[model samples]
Target: MQHLDLDFVRQQFPMFQTELGQKIGFLDNAGGSYVAGAVIDRLTDFYTNYKVQPYGANPISNRAGEAMELGRRTMAELLNVSADLITLGASSTQCFNTLSIACTPLVAKGRSAAAGEVIVSEQDHESNIGGWERLCQQQGATLKIWPVDPESGELALEDLEKLLSNKTAIVAVTHSSNIIGTINPINEIAALVHGVNAKLVVDGVSYAPHAWPNLDVLDADAYVFSTYKTYGTHLGVMVVREDFLQELAPQCHFFNMPYPNKRLDSAGPDHAAIAALAGIGDYFAALHDHHFAGKKGLPLHRKARAVAALMNQHENELCAYLLENLNDLPVRIFGRKTIEQREANIALSSPKISSKALADGLAEYDIAAKNGHFYAYRLLQAMGVADMNDGVLRISLSHYNSLEEVERCVAGLRAMLG
Candidate 1:
């Protein structure tokens, strides 16, 4: 029965203190979230004090190296996974691309015993689909689509069943659709994918912002999410299961190849960004302490899950309120009309007004919603949207978002639709 303290939550983000941030109702969180003040502090500290090459015999270099390692270890702790299993990259797209290339050894001609097959979902963003498609083509492997219901934009579990076979080597899908907002059954999908002896690679970019990832129970061979979307610095965090990682060819330099964590890191990301990740852990710990009185001693991931429950509850209430109010409007909601089986993210378009026009109108109200394909072009196309460029108007919420913000958005939509 512990409700999230919105005031306390908003205080943690420095953006809310600014004039422009206070004026705008930011509903574009699906693209990226505001960085926490703690994260900013960490980034600043790293640049100010230890802005040199890491791990050298010099004292300053050692401090820099230690800071980056702490950041890496903290992220692993946040996900309840081993540090060696996590890979940090500039973006999830880059992580997936590196992974796809690393997978070449599994699918390339004369690389493996069979011509491998890779299955991608129509419900996923291009970040999860395109790389695998190109890999399949390059390797002379078959590529299969797990189609969504054209009308509903829901991917059927039965359709996925048909795609699994002995030839399948990889199945790439989203943990939740960035545009559709529906949370896919990744655990069930993992079970099915593993039955065919194929590795499951999940893009958790959309899901992690709403719910901090728990890799301990999830059976996915690799799970990827963007830290920038999770109130941290801009970076992609990919956790590869030890066994699956051992099978892929290393993407790093020969000297770094021996390190399992560095194997998928094709290009080293910003040092300060990596160090800033420690702040995300700090932010979560602060939230957990504020909400839960006596469980301060719980592990980092446990604390994160506790905090995530409150966040999900607050976001779902706002989402349901927005959906109910929009019921009278002419806009066509793309995913579940209710909050059931969906994140706070919602996408809709209307024949009465163009998506761009609606977005522009909301801007008049100082609302920060957007209209576009949002990189889920295939999903929008499958759902029969006419203008892929304009796509659907998206209202993606974060924990820091308030009911007042939701009201402002609903009011904007009502005035525009009417």
Candidate 2:
């Protein structure tokens, strides 16, 4: 495998050429990533040329409709799912909430004395946990939490098996923790959930930026991620298996129930944003061609996987360096302190200084690190961190980050700790 061409990769993102991007080491990518130039250009083109109501019987309208469909088709191709199965929404939170509402009516039926069970992971963001909890409460279903190991910040599969029973109707979890950064085994979990005839919904917002997961291989009932976090527009992309889509009640109007794409979205689609998301596919194809020359004719998903492999290798190197330095400093690092078990997100609490103080100090060195519970408030509270207000300092990285940037971040942390 060829090593990532950092220069070629950095050129795709216009942010790196900006004065602020040049001066600051952006380690707060988990909050959101800088958009690629392709996405920006596409958004501009849509508004300039095709800003009409799509699917109408006119020239500009037809072009607008084609652009919107192209985005959906490209995203579906990248995820290895059918185009009709994918829905572009406002955000991942909205998507999950809509899904929960649609599922409540269906799953509430045939309940036993124990009530139907929905298993959620404590490590998930509020988007994944809260919606299901609300559904369970409203429908008189039991909500079970799959707890993570307080010391290691790991979710054990054995514990998940214990929670599984015949009453389980749904299991919601994250593909990777936004705080801990540990990559969960979705395929295994999907199989386990399927064995009990329960639906599995995966939150892929954090993981999707690092890797474009093959939904066919994962076989999840539903999967969701944010395009803005993956170098695209500010919209959420969700894929539901056809059978699963049929199982849920329509959240949209009665007339739209026949249309799979419109069944879940309550409002009109973001036409410009949906059209711009095709840029993600454009960026991925560009990266693949640049790294592996003449490897053309491959499917979009295969190209995405190829680009992902290159990104993962580069990111792991950066993660390894940060882990070594933080471990040497003896900071209380959360999650697995190894590259093989986690993504590039690392959260650490300093015994000598408050997390907020450390984050504030790092800013002086032009390192944009963040300190907070990061919406995984329950995870922090469960880990016995007394200062949830201060939380831990999180250093999140993406493929655009370089070794030199990692060294600079480490140097900043070292100086602050010293």
CA lDDT of each candidate?
A: 0.93, 0.88
Model 2 misplacement above 4 A: 109-114
Query: Candidate 1 — worst ten consecutive residues by lDDT sum?
Result: 105-114
Candidate 1: pairs in clash: none
- What's the lDDT of the predicted structure labeled candidate 2? 0.88
Superposed Cα deviation of residue 30, candidate 2 (Å): 1.1
Measured by lDDT, the strongest candidate is 1
Cα deviation at 243, candidate 1, in Å, is 0.5
Residues 227-256, model 2: lDDT tens digits: 888988888888888999998888888998
lDDT of 1 by residue, 55-109 (tens): 9899999999999999999999999989999999999999999999999877756
Residue 272 Cα positional deviation in candidate 1, in Å, after optimal superposition: 0.3
lDDT of 1: 0.93
Off by over 4 Å in 1: 110-113
Number of clashes in every candidate structure?
A: 0, 0
